[model samples]
Target: MPTPASPQRRIGVLLVNLGTPDSPQTPDVRRYLNEFLTDGRVIDMPAAVRYPLFQGLVVPLRAPKSAKIYQQLWTERGSPLLYHGLDLQKLVQEKLGKDYVVAFGMRYQNPSIEKALDELRAAAVDRIIVLPLFPQYAAASTGSVQEKVMDIVSKWWVVPSISFISTFTDDPGFIGTFVTLGKAEMAKREYDHVVFSYHGIPERHVLKGSHNNYCKLGTCCNSYNKNNRYCYRAQCYETSRQLAAGLGLAPEQYTTSFQSRLQSRLRDPWLQPYTDEVLKEMPAKGIKNVLTFSPAFVADCLETTIEVGLEFKEMFEEAGGEHWQLVPSLNSHPQWVEGVVNMIHRN
Candidate 1:
């Protein structure tokens, strides 16, 4: 008699985001900050140094202030980041159909990665595809997600085939979504210049990951290649380049910058042409009307929605700029949902 074949099993898809506090309250925000800042990849400090510093000084000192920001960020739907991730999870699940099992998790706090992986394990998935929702790869975000998943699943008695989608910055759908959003904003107002601001990482992090000390962190990032392919700053520039090209912008028409650095005198230097500094300088440069794009984020989180949209706009106008507008992020836009589905298929 012929040997029996193994039973069919669905492919598991786990989508992860950076995470948010359980609530906008100070205590909840403090707990969230404690978890987020304590990660070695994030602070890039030794346990002896990182834990005490963040848990004792940073978390306690910043919690109330950060809580106020989170409070402003909170909506009737609660955290935009969490809700958007949930919505994307449902959309991707519906599109992928019954052949795949989809789960959503945050790297830290509630709905943890361990919970998501357990759901997949219960489904007896033959293979699991881990997709960290960050379009660009960074040790602090995407890398943390990958590390957490492996640490959780390594103990499984029967491990399934596993893979990760690291970076999709150059994906047509990713670039096109921003292009569409940017174009919509530009059409509404004639701006003198455009700004592309990505979230800033400490300069040392990029230097630490520098392959054979290849990254100069200057014009070197103007071109992306194998040597600097994984460099976060380079990846940001590449995204800006692609978006600029898609929007038919010349070199002088747009500028690339970084934002949201931890404002600490003790901290190491962060990536520059800092977004705030650039925005303030624009008025003196005679660029009055400005349109900004926070391509670093896919959803309108505190960073994009408040930092770039509200805070930055106020800074621009105060510095004598006439108009400043922020392009919205790709939350549940049909095109972005389709793009994400295509990524799932392609990977």
Candidate 2:
């Protein structure tokens, strides 16, 4: 008789999202904000300056109000972002089967990245693949996730080979999912125009990452190429381009903008034409009925649900707009789950 050989080690798949507070409570929101804001990549400032500025002033002022928004955004399943991530994890796991171990984690709060990595380590995976949920590559989002993963994995005596899917800004499956969602919405009404809005980062961050000072952050982003491959603004425009083409939108039928900026006392520029400002100005231009897309987010978090879906809708209506339709994010949509599985296997 011969002893049976052990099965080969499985690969690990970790899906990471930006995260949410533990609860809608003010305390939980404050704590989450503190951890999120203090990250060096996010603040892009020295610890001395970042801590005092964020902790002393920003978090305290922002948390309670943010908590109220979170309260509105919360549902029976708790945070939509977390639950959706979990749903996607389960679907991706089922699709990958026994060959891979899948886990979900958030960058900031509960089910933290450290815990997710621990699960992969416990599974004794041979290699780990990290997929940050952000489509566009930004130092503040995907970069932070990658850096944190490295910091944790470096501590292990025997580290597994790790790879990251940095950006899927132009992936067909990702674009297709958004297109399907957009088509479904567009069928319901004849919108006057379309707007693609992405999360805004500081202009300085874009300048810092610019290759050879090529990114003026204006017309430079109108065309996407290797020179601005990792440029967040450029990638965003690229996403918009693919999505617009998919939805059968003519170039004149759509426009791009940035949203969800921080209140910078210094008036530091962030990526723009701002979403709110654009919506406000559109009615006067006779673009009253509009369709909006938030491609930067794959899930309906506070930014998508409360800010754009609810808040922006109200703003547009107040500005004399007739119909404001926000195409929902790809939250555990079948296509998106399929896309995630494809992304995992391809990487």
Candidate 3:
């Protein structure tokens, strides 16, 4: 049998998210985008090709408009994504008690990974559990986080034991909390259809994740199997399946789609049907009123609050759809809070 952990072993828990702009201004947004997009996992291009794209094109053109969106998403306390993460950190810390030191940080900008790591190191933690706030595994999200953390910690004078939670695709408590939240929303109104819209990665991201031709971009991903278990696309579909089964949804009652694709030089197709395109055509298929669930994001951020909640609402309204209901993300909800506590304990 394995040796039991020491009684004096102090633990540090770091909760992480994608990130937010330091401020909701053009320059701030530009700076944030410059750092975020330049990550190799995010852009996935060599420095020779990636440098010009963000500096000359992406950041310069998108910053101003993206700033306006952040302005709308900003709260009196600060960005919703940042504040919600703080709340979650506090809640989980309280539940875990005095032995554990819990801190929240963003992959980019303020409360950065460097700051969070420094906090843990100063505390003289015996071991660290780094949990990326994403439910599903994607290299651009979880992989980027793991790589960044290790790179920083490797230089520490005295490195301690480290653990990382890459994904929670099949955790019972994790899936159950979402089902509870979704059912509560569905009871308030009857919807014509429900859509599980996940953030889109470049199609090559999915193909690169597949093992031995596991992902055929066909019905193959519709079911979960060992070959495709690590695949991001497959895990997303599995989340949708579990929630749909819990809610007693019929096979035809819901569908999966992807959102936030970039216009890159490569013609590689992102996942389909695209959420924006699908929303426009949903009304024509006799499904006027709809509800959307963005499971990829735990906290309602730019993509969830503005992109799906507000922007897509406008699109559906313009298309003559009667209703566009967006299920709020699981941001420090009580059940979700407890569930996260359980997840930390599992490690």
For model 1, the stretches where C-alpha displacement exceeds 4 angstroms are 1-6, 263-267
Give stretches of model 3 more than 4 Å off: 1-7, 264-266
Q: Ten-residue segment with the worst summed lDDT in candidate 2?
A: 263-272
RMSD to the native, candidate 2? 1.4
- lDDT (Cα, tens digit) per residue for candidate 1, span 166-190: 9987889889998998899888879
TM-score of each model, paired residue for residue: 0.97, 0.97, 0.96
For every model in order, what is the number of clashing pairs? 0, 0, 0
Q: What are the RMSDs of all candidates, in order?
A: 1.5, 1.4, 3.0
What are the runs in model 2 whose C-alpha is more than 4 Å off?
1-6
Instruction: Indicate the worst ten consecutive residues by lDDT in candidate 1.
Output: 262-271
Clash pairs, model 1 backbone: none
Residue 258 error, candidate 2, Å: 0.4
lDDT to native, each model: 0.91, 0.94, 0.90
- Order the candidate numbers by TM-score, best to worst: 2, 1, 3
Candidate 3 lDDT? 0.90
